[model samples]
Target: LPTSSSSEDFHESSSSESSDGTSGTPTLEPVPSPVPEPLCWEM
Candidate 1:
């Protein structure tokens, strides 16, 4: 379940990043993972 864990971690970090104005970094990581596309775009 590495992907699941990684996605969760990405979300947690992304949430924090969203408040910091550096959200782009987290979104970029998920761009290559098709499953995370929606999540990334939503952020």
Candidate 2:
């Protein structure tokens, strides 16, 4: 479950204040993400 910590960190960063959470959803599959921004967030 520790691997999920990486996803948690994304939520803590720019998306922490993200109200809709819709934007954050794509982070779940950042492996095939089209946007560099979301890919960056995944890391």
Candidate 3:
């Protein structure tokens, strides 16, 4: 029972971490693109 509980906790943490990483990538990509777009527009 204890092992199963621990496994569940581990799985939850792993899933959350994976989700965070996936989200972080998209946010970072948009940030750089916006920065370049304004510069390109001004130029």
Each model's number of backbone clashes?
Answer: 0, 0, 0
Summarize candidate 1's per-residue lDDT along 1-43 as a digit string, tens digits: 9999999997777566675677766666666676667777999
Question: Can you tell me which runs of candidate 3 are displaced by over 4 Å?
Answer: 17-43
Which residue pairs overlap in candidate 2's backbone?
none
What is the total number of backbone clashes in candidate 1? Answer: 0
lDDT by residue (tens digit), candidate 3, 1-43 = 9999999998677556656557755755678788999999999
Clash-forming residue pairs, model 3: none
Model 2 C-alpha lDDT versus the unseen true structure: 0.67
lDDT of 2 by residue, 1-43 (tens): 7779988887677567554667666654563556777768899
Assess each prediction's global lDDT (C-alpha) against the native. Answer: 0.73, 0.67, 0.75
Model 3 scores worst on lDDT over the 10 consecutive residues at: 12-21
* Displacement of the residue 42 alpha carbon in candidate 3, Å: 44
Better of 2 and 3 by TM-score: 3
| Regions of model 2 farther than 4 Å from truth | 15-43
